[model samples]
Target: MSTTSTEPARRAGWRTETFARLDERLDRVLGATAKEFEKLRVRTVGDLMLHVPRRYFSGTELSDLSQLRVGEEVAVLARVLRTDVHQGHGGRSARGGMNSRLTSVISDDHGRLELTFFGKPQVMDYWRRQLTPGARGIFAGKVGEFRGTRQLTHPDFVILGDHGEIVGGAKRNAVLAEVTRQPLIGLYPATAKLRTWTIAQSVGLALDQLAGLPDPLPAAVRRQARVIGLEQAYRAVHQPQSKDEIDGGRERLRFDEAFALQLTMARRRADAKAHGAIPRVRRDGGLLAAFDARLPFTLTAGQVEVSEQLMSELARPQPMQRLLQGEVGSGKTIVALRAMLAVVDAGGQAALLAPTEVLATQHYQTVLKLLGDLAGGGLLAGAGPSTDVVLLTGSMPVAQKRAVKLKAAAGEAGIVIGTHALLGEGVQFADLGLVVVDEQHRFGVEQRAALSAKAAAQPHVLVMTATPIPRSVAMTVFGDLEVSTLKEVPAGRADVGTVVVDAKNHPGWVERAWQRVIEEVGAGRQAYVVCARISSQPKRKSTDAYAEDLDTDPGGEDIEPAAAAVDVYAELSGGPLKDLRVDLLHGQLSSEEKDAAMSRFASGETDVLVATTVVEVGVDVPNASMMVILDADRFGISQLHQLRGRIGRGGHPGVCLLLTKTAAGTTARDRLDAVASTRDGFVLADVDLEQRREGDVLGASQSGGRSSLRLLRVLDDADLIAEAREIAEACVAADPELIDPGLSDIVTHVERQAAGDWLERT
Candidate 1:
């Protein structure tokens, strides 16, 4: 047999070993080690194959010695400049010398590194010969520093020939083709329990056993895209022979991810079109027109354009699946209200779902204020030919809740605004033609599906978010829906300025933040004091999505918790703002207490509202001219922007102070600085995506220890995504049901990896 065939036969024992079954359960193949793989969610051989390396470290990609950090495990491929064997110190060594160390100086074009070895004369001589001047090899070791110089001690290494083969270690001519593979180290996303090398070994074993895998991409499509076949892609990614192979492998995998996702979206669009929706067309001089005519200010051009688009979609027979992404304080609520009024005009009820009770109440009051007597349909004298707007919430008195439910059931309530309570049983809409979800990310897909299920037919869905989504994200995250952006900040909005206060470098700035709040309150305006937590306790409720705001690490060393709402409220009430009215609000508070606190603040009875991120959205107090966010580094870019949005309303120039103890050069501090630098939500969204992984942006779990994207970079691969989208649409057009089982399987796998809300089932 040829040396290449014999090497695998001898090392793998493939002569007796059966071919690895791709469909085999991991537990069967991995034995006890299967438990470790389970942590990474690799349950089958196929899953293991798909767990491609996150990155490869090759000679060209290795960092120079100057870039090495102390106590870091690293791999370096460099030319050996010189070698010296010496004995050091007075202490007796195993060979009767003071721990003799061999130092070899190695260099790349950029810098040099020291490789130290400690051994007897024979071993030292061997190393000396192997690491002579001008010799090139791969050195793997943990970096250390002695006398301020970086060094690697007794590193694991392989001396390589000019052609990249292990010198004198194996036969040259017969296995030259196989052994000349580039010296590249594939780094898997590893965990403490399973190291990267272990995973690589397992992958190597699987590759050796498996062969001739079916290609999911059609032959013609593969040729058109110029991507490698599935089997070749897997082999290249897992054990690439060259950098070109790695690139080819990653391109195919990226295309696969994008194609599968786009196909799912295309199918969803087709299904939405197929499912009939009653056209809730507008009526002239109806509630929408009446509401629009009485507007205190002219609608911005962006709002008018989006509103027109929404109305036209609502007039269609197909259900409208549209996403309205707007900047903070861009008057999105007004645009949504107009659409709701249009639905009411068509004799159908519109249900608006808010993520929080506070937001629901805010919307309820806003609608009532905007409608004035027009909201009192059939219930009051001198009322217009309008419709009733009702607020439904979990904390409402049982009798009041029952009455509201009956009105909704009897078609008397034309507009229903509520939290998740609207999705509960017995809350019926007589003719639910529209469903509007505010802060769409706050709820899951099941919640949205539940609300839509209430309508007799598929309800025209309009989901809105004040946190502007980048166009790429909108295409990937909300691919199933049509996207509309409202960037025009209405005229007369008070210009808001943001400043980052470095509490660590300048502790006085924190005190100044509190004083600023006092100053705003003294000027007859309100202010908000926001914190990252409700308490200093280390505990966090899993149900609270914002629990990440707490700076405490659950698994690492105990830390001094970030500022808490309750603690800040107490301190301010007694110290800085003793003369002013102050109240506290957080998710832990009872619903009544939260409402009362918000009400007090809204009515100017409370000069300062100390709260957690509960005030991040929809609690509008236009008179609130200042915001002091403590431990602001804990909040995200989008969240900081949203909290800042609460201010600068009602033509009161706003000031936002971001207080953070994070050091100036840290990533956390950089995030805070970015937020302070721009008020544009879209710019911040891009910054946020740049800082976070694609999996985080999509809200998917890192199943294989890396992003669900694996190899696809959402921001950098926009052209690839667009091409995949085009190809996907064409594929769906030709085979609407995805008759090819392989293509169907790919789509199903993609759906499993995504957030469940990305797809909606009829």
Candidate 2:
């Protein structure tokens, strides 16, 4: 060959050499000193670290022979009493072409077992010569079932007679019962090479060759978390010596995960507090007094306590960053109104932001009613003839919007209520002092920063979430912000006694309930029929018929009105109830339509309004007493609680009917029963957590990417998580910056937690 032609092979050899050297460097990087295989080309050590299991075979023990089920790998020791070479059993020859031909029978005193050596007559010859017929040999092999009998197929056996200890052992029993397994053996799963012997072979090699990988967590982290190192963790996880070790490792991982999360939250809070520039205002109690005096009912102790704490925060110079948490109907709004009043009386503008326009309108109207009568000059009336409160919803008239915009910009709209639309670029505040955010958990940390940036000075913010967070979770998730809970309900409000009724019994319940509503309305009360599905949801194709898609709802305008689902709305409004002012209220309706429907409902124009859970939050129709659900089982207990909260605001003998359709399934019945048992939303939340896992709870993926977790479980280790979180706090308190040399490795670990792809390597 010419030199030019031979260059191609030379270059190929060079590339292979380069690859080998790179792999060597990677191995060094992964702390490997010696390369194991000289011929095989390997990937980077980092790549190898990510070689988790395709599956786990989970090892076993031979002692528990009775526990040996049909599908288990059992190891036994036996003597090879005899060996024989023959042609293949089923009329095939072993001494020929590449075929499954050679057969050998291995025998012990217990029995004779056949061993097949496919296409390898030399294998039999080697065994016969080495084993020496009638001399004892040790067999380390897999047990296979052949013709309803246990047999060893192509077993790996060694002659033990040559060994000095077993020189004359063939006279005794040929089989030895010294069988031992890892007890609960963990396997590296199988591949296409799936004979029971195949997986066993790979595992045997791996166990012999693989070294225990070290966990990098420092001693301080382990001591603080009351846990073990990474190697111990892996061992305990796979081949746990005892139940206690397994539990201990699990505790360590849980604590580590929770501690990481807590540190992140704490760091964010501390950084924000440190970097923020807040305007401290002197204490003002006069406005709160006036607002409370005009209120209709006495404040619950929880409300009073929260209100006092919030007022104290406002009174100080510190940025009033606090989370206002409580169950449904626990009077968080009243506390918000009082805090806003405090800012208003201080001659500072205030904004009350809500997640939905419906809630904004309701809150705006409540404030308007309070300020318009007898003290009409207290709040902005927008473009309307009065000057009591400014309602800046997307549905408001353009002129009204302009007036509210101008007044809020000029520091004249003392208290403004609106949706996230209020955070629009065009809106400017004269001096935003108090910003009350409803459904706080619904918003993220970045949104909080953007909203705070809108004011002249960073405003004191009071965040509210309707979810009744458990006390333990509250401590960590909202640890940065001061927490104020509203436990007790308002006085004179009747407890909405919940009852679960299955749909197997749901035929005439709606009609019967409607009749009761008619009587209550005839007696001057209103009724609400909450439909589950909205109209815009795509209809399931007939071919794609799946039972779970039956109640799938179609569409809604986020931050707007609830959309109409034709089925339920048509059943109630287009059917027998046509005579009443039965109107549809949904998020898909135009702004004007939503405003018209809400205004009519507020003005007693619509007697029975059919809608979705869009009315769940804060739409207060005092005269609306009866709440009827069409497909109650389709919704979570939290949603059910919110819907029930819409009614019972009027102080009448209110009744709620939860009508469930798919009542047959056990899960469906449990959901309905959970709703029917109590009105305590917090308790229901705990139950909700117990039922569903973490993925569905935080609802993270819908907002963006998947939630971060590898092997961590949220609910399974709640107690461990809580304890871990406390230890993390203490650790950080001891070393505020995590600059301690001992924790530097963990600091790198935490940084990599939010970074890309590092976890995937692990």
Identify the leading candidate in terms of TM-score. 1
Q: After superposition, how far is residue 46 of candidate 2 from its true place, in Å?
A: 12
For each candidate in turn, the TM-score is 0.82, 0.66
List where candidate 1 sits over 4 angstroms from the true fold. Answer: 1-25, 38-47, 57-61, 64-183, 208-210, 377-384, 394-401, 444-446, 538-559, 700-707, 755-762
RMSD of 2: 14.3
Q: lDDT score of model 2? A: 0.58
Q: Which candidate is the best by lDDT?
A: 1
lDDT (CA) for every model shown?
0.76, 0.58
For model 1, what is the alpha-carbon lDDT of residue 347? 78
For candidate 1, the 10 contiguous residues with the lowest summed lDDT are 1-10
